[model samples]
Target: MDHDHTLFHRDDVVALRHDLALSLRAAAHHGLGEGICNHFSVMLGGNSGLFLINPHGLHWAEVGPDDIVLVDERGERVAGAHGVERTAMFIHAAVHKLAGKTCVLHTHMPHATALTVTPSGKLNTKLSQNAMRFHRRVAFDADYNGLAFDETEGERIAAALQGADVAFLANHGVVVCGESLAAAYDDLYYLERACQLEVLARSMGGGLAEVSDQVAEATAAQFARDRDQSRLFFEALRRELPLP
Candidate 1:
């Protein structure tokens, strides 16, 4: 496939590349990445049918702006030096298309994946303040049909989201989607923290303390109103990381 040099060089596209690379690096820094398996992607801009994703075989820590691959809806690599991972194409493409998510982040970070393998099957949003941020904003896919080797599995997973921003994939991993890279990464980072807290609480062997539905809903509303915080958090990551 021919490369779109002009599109890649556009200022907004360049900035998005930087943001995506920074997000991958930050996820690795926070130990949220699992080798080269998990993937992150962002739509180019406003349903352009093109998106940016990290190439296969590159560790998240080493992915730079130039390493982000441009992939079209058909799973073809429009640009970048390396090929897209099969699952990355299937899962991300379906979510981008079917779910209409602008940014999709899929990971198997330990604490969150831990919850997936449990009988509870999802996060307890009313259990902790951090968890409250996701109140009524999570979906669960109880069916784990193995690796997404094709589009059908991907569509199934996307449909499983059921209009929620976060999805807990039963016995597999977690998917976090948002309107932008900053927003998605913010949710991914905090989701792990919330899961970590819950897992730790469970290990302590006492009855867990959960807040009332009214309190959880109120807290989530407050978080929803403070959308700028997600942008600020991503900016902080960019500043802290050794990106150039």
Candidate 2:
């Protein structure tokens, strides 16, 4: 059964489910996933009012697209035979509500999570590709206000993400949203890598060097030129896990 569309089709929903499962499993295999606390979602159909999110309390490796629950704009479960996470509803719902039908990935991956706890938490661009991809797309949340369980907190986060596509939830984790799951996953993957490198470099105690603004911008622009890069990255990651 197909749903109304403004930009995506039924196949797109299928593709999103497969990708989320693959991405989740890969994250689990790489020790990025933390039990069953994270959530990954992609917008389905053209209305920009609904999304597919992982079922609450399910491990990333076990989640399938078919297992993904469809949620409408108001955090209401609309499809699938599963329930959504409460925090996922508050956070992802608010994100989609403001960003419009977009894929949103939230996780408590190691390095990124570690960095979020620091007083001056930031995604230091010391790692080349990590630096390149994250350049200006990151938004840092300075306060860890516990689990997001209300529209107000969600709205605060949406406002924090004003012009960026990624956010580091202080004392919590990271959030990456995009026009597609491929793009969002690509960002989330590299974001963790970048955070890892930054933490490592800081441990060396010699400070870090940043790429010039011109160079960073040029690199990001080059990546943007290849719209298929996101999908390509996802495909490469799939080869590692190969299943949900």
Candidate 3:
């Protein structure tokens, strides 16, 4: 929470914008994006109460430094473009109000969202090692009240996600947030991979042999103690982008 409270260097904004675009393109290439519908954001300028996201209507691959939209905590557009997506505003604005997390990434990635819509969409820790990484760490929002078009909806989502790094909205999709942009992207990537593995395993009709709660907990502990794992994963992915 409150990552910083000082003036953000101009170069900070420049790097934030560039890295954000790279992440968007990476998401697109990996088929983790919908038809310009998902949202990703990073806070801009320390203590400036400002954040940046791609403007509505731009495909993830098309997002660039100039196309990034700046918005206040209230979700009003302050820079880059005229309008912000209503649901994007609703969810992101509410989340950024909290501390600790800086970058928030929400997606309709098929693998993960497919699980969300199923009766057992919640990630089961016993499902796989990746699943174990989220053991007892996921917030499941069992209710889906249509689209998040207002602040009230945003507040609800934020409340459901409290104290957790990831939120799996039943019948909706997933939300991943992290203290840094790389961590956020890395988590999103792993989340989708975990879901894909689970779904495929289930498709084999083996009835999902999940690990015991004890083992799952141990795996989660191991993941939490993992130093720089997410950073390394994200950096490797970033190198494949047009530029860092």
The regions of model 3 sitting more than 4 angstroms off are 1-9, 98-100
Winner of 2 and 3 under TM-score: 3
TM-score-wise, the better of 1 and 2 is 1
> Per-residue alpha-carbon lDDT of model 3 for 1-244, expressed as tens digits?
2333232235777778777888898899899999979899887645677888877898888777767777778776666644678789788877878534588899988888988988876777788898888888788888889898767776777888878989898888999988888888888998999999988987898777878999999988998898499888778877877752
Q: lDDT of all the models against the reference? A: 0.93, 0.76, 0.81
Model 3, position 202, has a per-residue lDDT of 77
Residue-wise C-alpha lDDT for candidate 1, range 118-143, written one tens digit per residue: 99888999999999999999999988
Model 1: residues >4 Å from true position, as ranges?
1-5
- Quick one: best lDDT, which candidate? 1
Best-to-worst ranking by TM-score: 1, 3, 2
On residues 59-163, what C-alpha lDDT tens digit does candidate 2 reach at each position? 887876678777776767767767887888888877777866377888889898898888867686534666677777788877667778877767777778877
Q: Score candidate 3 by TM-score against the native.
A: 0.90
Candidate order by lDDT, decreasing, is 1, 3, 2
TM-score of each: 0.97, 0.88, 0.90
TM-score of 2: 0.88
